[model samples]
Target: MVEKDGIVRVGLDAGMNALVRPAMYDAWHDIVNLQRIDAPADGQFDVVGPICESSDLFGKRRRLPRDTAPGDVMLLADTGAYGHAMASRYNLRELPPEDVIDGPVA
Candidate 1:
């Protein structure tokens, strides 16, 4: 996480490596901080990745919990196949494992 020019930026571990639609098509993905689901959204943040490129940003001016911090579990909603199908090891980043459930998850 970083704060510069009064703008908060949160770096995510899951980047173009797992979802490239954001960087490739400038797509908008609903970013949710699972840990702060019930917390008030008092912070504006730019959700980014560790990739060394300006296009690695996933979201901008995102409203999230004011105390969003490292180790927080985040979810990029509505990715579908466009995001996952285009994932690549462009930065030599290893592909993360994915879980598929057979039925509705509790």
Candidate 2:
């Protein structure tokens, strides 16, 4: 959901149902474009989820790759500790499917 205003609207498959930290306390999550790690930061972005509420955001004014756009897989850092554990059924959005990475840490 990249907008013309230079704000990338990133919608996650899951929203408040899978992570409430952001909407609850204005938590800040680091976002990175793994495919464009070397790209420069062109402007700010609003990394959000698919939730209906406006508070269902991951990061505000986040600095990401200048070429960042829709369909690009961005990594939300530091969510392993309490991401899925804090999920709920709010907004009737289903929780995101879980995955287990069985390899060396990148």
Query: Best-fitting candidate, measured by lDDT?
Result: 1
Candidate 1 residue lDDT tens string, 24-59:
788888999999999998999999988858888899
- Candidate 2 wrongly placed segments (more than 4 Å): 2-8, 100-106
lDDT for 73 in candidate 1 is 88
Off-target runs (Cα >4 Å) in candidate 1 are: 100-106
**Model 1 worst lDDT window (10 residues):** 96-105
Q: So what's the TM-score on candidate 1?
A: 0.88
Error at 11, model 2, angstroms = 2.8
Give the per-residue lDDT digits (tens) of candidate 2, residues 1-106: 6575655676666576787888888777788877788899776778788765888788888887767776777777777758878887776666777765566778
Listed in order, each prediction's TM-score against the native is 0.88, 0.77
